[model samples]
Each structure stands twice: as C-alpha cells, then as structure tokens.
Target: MASSSDPKLPPLMKAQFLEAFNKPYVLRSVPLPTVTDPHDMLIKVDAASYCHTDAVLAAGQMRPNPPSFPHIGCHEFAGTVVALPEISTSPFQVGDRVGVPGRAFHPCGTCFECASSPTAEDADADPPGYSVYCPRSQNNGIDAPGGFREYAAVDSRQVAPIPENLSAVDTAVLMCAGVTVYAALKRCRLKPGQRVGIMGCGGGLGHLGLQFAVQMGLEVWGVDNADAPLRLAGEVASGARVIDARNVDATEVVARLGREDGKQDRGDMGLDAVIILPESQDAFDYGVSLLRNHGKCIVVSFPERGFHVSARDVVFRDISIIGSLVGSNKLLRETLQFAAQNNVRAVIRTFPLSRLNDLVAEYHKGRGGKLVIDMALSDGS
Candidate 1:
C-alpha cells in the first residue's frame, strides 16, 4: 500500500481474479502492487482492453503453460506511472503516461538472440521488435499481476510512453492489436502499391491491420463475413475493398486479382501478401490460395485447434507462411508513434470494470471493434 503522503494512491484496490481453470472471475479488493525490482514501476491503470487471448485463457485452452490460478487476465493496457524505483535505468518518471503490451519480455542483453541482433541506440535494450522473442521474457497478467487491477507492477523495459494525442482507451488497443498488425505487415515487407488482403478485417485486430496496410501504401482488401464489420472497415480504413467471405469464393477472387501468366506488368494484380487475422481454418486456407507465386502470407491469429497447410502449395508456389507473435517493445513504440502521426485510432466501446463478466460474455459472442474496461468506473456505474 502507498503511504498517506500520496493521496491518489489507495491502500486497497479492486481487481478481477481467476480462481481456477473454467471458473468465473472473482472481483474483490486487494492490495495494490508495489515496486520491488530496480527496473519495476507501479502503474495506476487507466484502461485495459479485453482480447480473445484472455477469453481463450479463461477457457483453459492454453494448456501445459496456462497462467497460474488466482491470476489477473488482461495483457493490453495503459496507465499513469505512480511510482518508480529509487535507483532505476528507465527514462520514465512518475506520472508519465504509458502503454503496456501483453508480453514485455526483457532481453538478457547477453543471450545469443540479443547479442546477434542489432543493438538499440541506447545499447542497453535489444534491437527494436526482438525483445518480445527473448527466451527469458515475462508476460504481464499471466506471468505476474496484470492491469485488470487498479495498480500493476510492470517492468520499465516493457512500458512505452503514450503520445499526448492518443487517449488511454485507444492506447490500450494499440498495445496489443495495433503492434500485432504492424509487426505482421512489417514481416510481409511489401513494396508500395502492392495488393494486400486482411482476413477478419471487421474485427479488432483485422480493422487495425487494414488501416495499417492502407497507411503503408498498399492497395487493401478487407475480408469478413459480417456486414457491420465490413461497413466499419470501410468507414475507418477508407478505400479498402470489402469482401464477404461467406458469399464469395476467395480462391476465385485471388485468381482474378493476380496475373495468370506470372507477368509482373498488371497493376496490383494478385496479392503480394495476405495477412490472416482470423482464427478460422478456412480463412487460413483462403489466404494461402490468394497469394501470387513468391508472395507471403502472415498468420497472426491463434485458433483453438490446429489447422493444416498443404506442403505442395509451399513447394510449388514459393509462398512463405510466417507466424507472428506480438511485436517487440521497439515495434510497439513505433506503432504508437505511427498511429498518432497518421490519425489512425481504434474504434472502441468502454465498459466499467464491474461489468467484466458481461463484457466477457459479449466478447465470446464476437463483436465489432475493441472492448475496453475502464478502471475508473465503479460497479454501480
């Protein structure tokens, strides 16, 4: 508990706790987290966005290494720094606004991966976008107390300062969904004017991916089954070609969009890359089918069941299928900066923390846009 000297700090805080697997979350009062490690900071969370990963975790889907019981289960969040270690190397100060991604794994700085990767300008951190892959990474809300509570203790290396223009809600979404799509797009390495299709474009990550693809100068196609998602994608992304995956044959569409003879002269014919953002196996197959020879397909979603890919397609088409996790701290920072600069914002609906169960139910049903929990609100509100 923070001392009385800090009026804003509360001795006890409310948090949603998971007692065990396949159990409902228990919301109750708990002691606020304190800064123990030299590089740790105590953050007063402003907003925490719900993700499908959290839902999956709640269902006991991530077996073998699921979060230990009695844990908080949100990864994407943003807040203000309330306390910092007395002797710390972090540039952030108390009261600094910051956003945290799901897994902010700190690089050991001496590991093979870190040593081999390009060094940051500061020389202390790993190269941008590599820290998330560090072997000794710590995931918030899973490996430790998360932002579902009012105060969270986070490693400074995993926290990025939020731009002044972005609201807390938008920053929260960007922490997970934004950096994810941004990292996936970076993996594609598409040249300007290349065509890119985003599967599940109407959902949270999908919509953000579409905007990122557009901002990166790619001719974008938004693929989804729901009309609302398609309409929202068009509204926010602008100029994106919306396709109803339920009605259209994705393979045929790709064939018509790409050059049949392998001639490169056709303008934007055939997708240079397709980013599969949905959990549907059919969507994954369709994404692979839509790519031109030598094109790339980036898989960003995780379905409960494993999906099979044809080995023959990879061997013959020379198409690359890459799996992308959440972006590194460097990429997260870049995503925030890019979104702020480009006026790319997440469309979100805010709910009070008290309604967490209701929100989770809604999320399970699947909805358009992102769902964010506002910690400032009370249960009655």
Candidate 2:
C-alpha cells in the first residue's frame, strides 16, 4: 500500500470536508489512519452508505465535528482487512471482508457493560447508551472515522464477516438499517405465524423488516402511501399484503385482511405488533390505531423533538409503545448472518468516492433507496 514517494509508508490518504459545523465535505490529502493498538486492524473500505444520521451529523445536530480538524462522512460500510499489525485473533484474518456497525468503535474490552454481561444485562442496569463515549458527550466522535473514506481503522471485535457471495454495497446498508429493524423485531417478540405490520415498507429499514418478518414465518403486512414504494415492497417481500396508506384507513385495511370473519376474540386475530420505520407523525398515530387489543407499537425512527403520542388510547388498550436505538453487537451479528443467508440487501446507487460532493447533493434530492459510496472506485472502478 505504499505510494511512489514513500517506500515504507503509504501516501497520506485524502479526506473530503469543508470547515466543520456548516460546510460541505470535500476531499483533501490526509494520512491513512494507522493501527496503533494491537487489537486494531486497518481496512480498505469497499463500500459505505449515506445514512439519515450522517445528514444529522453533517447538519451540526449531533457533534459539530470529530476531534480531528477535517471530518469524513460514513458510519456504515463493508471492507477488507488490509493490515493486521498483531497476531490473528477472533474470526477475522488479513484479508477477510467485514462490515462495520456504528457501535463497533465504541466498545473498550474493559467497559462495564461488556464486563458485566456479555449475553444479557440486568433489567435495572443503566448502561452507557453509546459504546463510544467521552467524559464530555461531544468528545465521542473521535473513535472511528466514518465509512465514506478509502480506508478505516476499526476494532477487531466489532467486525462481522460477510459472505463472499454478498456484495459490499448490500452489506453496507445492512450494517445500520438491517440491524435496526432486527432490534425492533426482537422487541415485538415475533412468534411463528404471528402477524406484524411494517409502515414505510419500501425505504431502507422498512424493506429489510418485511423480508426479515417473512423469513421468520410471520405474516407481513407492508403499509406505504406511494405506489412505487408499495410496488417495491411487493417485489422484495413476496406474498406480503402491501396496503396503500392513502387509499384506505389502515385500521380498516388491517381488519379486512386479518382473520377469516374479519373479527377475532380479544386475543385471537388483531395485529400482534407494528414496526414504525418512517419519521412521519402520521405513521406513528396510524400504527397505534391499527393495533390489536394488547399489541405493541415499536418506534424505530427518531422523529423531531416535541412530538406527542396519545396517552389515553395507549392506557385504555393496554398497548405498549417503546423506542429502540440501533442495536448491540449480539443483535448486529445476528442481523449480518441472517442477511448473508437470506439474501437481504439494500437497494442502492453507487458513486465513485471522488464524486462524494455530487453524491451528497443528489442524496438531498430524495434519491430512492440507499446511496452507497464506492471507495474502491479510486482503483478498481
């Protein structure tokens, strides 16, 4: 990986960005991050996805800037481990292809959460929400550079091996969206043959949820307002009952597709749960309305602050609504395996890494599906 100028080390990698906290990202020559720790490996990024959270970070909502001067934009990506400065450990090797989840960089082997419970946490334990933490909340972004760059240094523990058959673009989207929907589905306690409805079924998260639900043996009902998304939902999750949210009342639509008689006992045939993946308040409200007597409404989207839900209806129906963050390593690993085996992939548009500026602008134009950055485009493309 050495360039012509330096024989011992590679030329400084370039990162693209403008001034922090309100400027567009631009690529400039920068050093390729090194593996200073024995447990770290240097990976050449193959692909990365542009997430809504990336937009938030770019817009100055999360952290104004990473600890470093220039910032790279990418959190979810799949790449090959190009260098391992220490002994080979865990499941990864020198050239193993792996996908990086957002939380991978946060875990310190000595963390209280990881030390206390590897499998399950105490119900009362108040664990640090993010694995990557700082004494000041703002110091948190320094651990791992985002996935948009040509190379990234990541902890071996956070890496998940991807199947050779799966493309990096597919793995990149699954790192976040797939893990999110998987976490939400677990909260629903999906049972074999149970019915679950997913709102916003054609977007990044919703589409994956539909496939996961179908593979788990649940009857999936996908709800979306637009015809194109609904059509995509049908194509991705065959046999799923795709409903047009605008054409009919969701409650009525769910009722019609429910049981044989369109009615069931208090426990028999209403929706077991609803997974709301869209940021719309309407989706949240509709999710509650379409629930069965004791159904759970799981909120996976981060809506703007000051949003409200109806307290009275929730109390009367015994329906529980809970919010979920991305997921833990355990759940993320399971999601990767499931996605690898079941062929779940993000529908994506690829752009060369150098064209990131154009890509970001197009992303704002409401591109359908996920947008992936092809880091390998510098050489391979």
Candidate 3:
C-alpha cells in the first residue's frame, strides 16, 4: 500500500461541467473535491465511461426536480486512490486501483431494506431502504458531482478494487453496465439449460448480458437489428442464437426458437426470461410475448418516454415484469471478479477528454459498445 504523502495532490483540476440543462458541458478548471466524510476517498480518475443516463440528464429529462446546475456528469469510472480521510476505515489504500460505481450514497443501515438479504426471492418482503435506487438517495452524476472530473471524492462503499488483469477502461464499463446485467440475471433466477433472450443483444449492456447468460449455462438468444454486433456475439458466446429484429418480429423469432406453441417436435419451450436492454416500448411488449408461463422480463434500460404493457397479457400469461437498477455493492464486486476469472471483456472506443463534446454528439447519433474518456491524453486546449 502506498502512503497518501507519496503522491503530490493538486489543488485544481480540469472537469466537464453542465452549467445548465440542455446545454453543452463546459470543460474548465475547478477546485478539487476534498474528503469531508470519514468514508470518503479521493481518487485520481484515469478513465470514465459514458452511459445513456448521462445523456438523458444532459437533455434535462429529469422530471419534478433536476440536479442543480454546474454538476459533473459521469458515474462509471476507474482510478487510483490518491488520498483517504484521517478517520477512514475502508479496505482500500492509497495508490490502489479501484472502480467506482454510480451509487455514491450510503445506505441508511437501520432500514429493513438495508438489513435484509439482497438476494431474497420475495421482492415485496424487503423493499430497498436507503439504497442508491431509493427515491430519497442522492445519485452520483445526477444529484451529486461525478467522475467526469480529473479527481472525485467517492464514498468507500461505492468503490470496488479493480483486478490486476483488467485495465481502467475495462473496469469503468464493469462499474455500471456489467453489474447491472449481472444483478438482473440473479433476479431472474433461471436454472441451467433454461432459455434466455437478450432484446438488444448488440448494445453495450445487452452484449454483456448475453455473455453472462451463456456463462451461466443458459441457452442464450440474441435479438438485434445490426449484423456486426450479432456476429461478434456469435464469435464470443458459443451456441448462442442470433435473430434479426429488423426483418423478422423479435417475439415471433423467440417463440419459434423456444417452441412456445404446443409442438414437441419443433424445439425448446418458451424462454424462462428475456432481459430488455433497449428503451423501446416495442421491445418491451415483444419481450413479454416471448416468455413462458411465470417467465420474467427484466427491464434494464431507461426510455425517456413511458412504456406500455398489456395488463391482460401479463395477468393471463402469468408473466413478471422486473425493473432492475444499476446494482448493489456486493454485486459490483462479484461482477468484477466474474469478469476477471472468465476473461469477459467490454468492447470500448476510447476518446481523449478534449473530445468529450464530440463524443456526446456521437452518442446521440447512436454507437455500438461503450464510449470511454481517457483522462491521460489531453489536447492541451
């Protein structure tokens, strides 16, 4: 472990800040955040990944109340610990490579939601108390400053140690996209040989979900409009089925593969679960139709517009619609460990911090895989 005195800490640093909603982020110098809380650790950010949530927040889509102006926006990132609070009891040490997840708020340990087991089967029995997904909690990159800056003062609970083999870029993706899908799968509780379909398998989160399902021994099926991502999925995940959502109906394709009809001669039965990674209402509606009795449809995407589902279909078909947030701290650690052990990697495109505006433009136009900001290389603007 390296001492805090070993690294020279700077008083000022460059960051991308949102001065107002629907406005371009201004890259400027700002005072570095200090560790005020006992559990706070100051991190020197190396890489940060862009998420759809960041784009949504930038567009001023947050309803009722929005995060105050001049907010830094990026929740998924990895860095080296530069300093720790004097009273800190966190396992992390200075100079330790760590990945920071979006959940920056500390759980109110007294609530039932915090005390109960996260893996419990009964959803209603133990609701989330002060977890990051809780309505009252302050969210990183939304309600609070985030990793878009050169340095961040993060809660120790939200930080996970990065494995030796994984690079900062890889750890950044795993912080958000990786753990999200991992927790969603855990919620599905699908057994081995059970069929699972990824609605947007070619997407950043979808591709990772496909890989996880395959690793868990579930018969995986990927639905996407593009050929490139599907081909990549085929190459990486063996015995995975890919369907083109552009021509053929996604629901129909899944049904045909799963043999949803009472025809024993065709193939397997209906899918046990379908993880919806796209924010499209069509995808959500179609995903429900592809499920077997008591099957689940895990929704992981955030569509700006509201989604509609048939209440009659849900009740009659005995289908469950589960909404998954980012993930818990325990799940985040497990996700990193799983990726390290299985050699699962996120496909990423790196951009210098100077090109952040251009990167945001490209994100609006739609891009495959995750887009990362490398803080090391700057244009010296």
Quick one: best TM-score, which candidate? 1
Model 1 residue runs over 4 Å out of place are: 1-8, 105-107, 119-125, 128-130, 258-269
Measured by lDDT, the strongest candidate is 1
**lDDT at 119, model 2:** 34
If the candidates were sorted by their lDDT against the true structure, best first, what order would they fall in? 1, 3, 2
Per-prediction backbone clash count: 2, 7, 0
Q: Candidate 3 overall Cα lDDT vs. reference?
A: 0.78
lDDT of 1 by residue, 65-114 (tens): 68887899889999998887666667888879999887754546566665
RMSD to the hidden true structure, all candidates: 3.4, 4.0, 3.4
Better of 2 and 3 by lDDT: 3
Q: What are the runs in model 3 whose C-alpha is more than 4 Å off?
A: 1-7, 115-119, 122-130, 227-236, 258-268
lDDT of 2 by residue, 261-352 (tens): 56655434468899988778888887777777788898987765624788775777788887876666667778888887877776777888
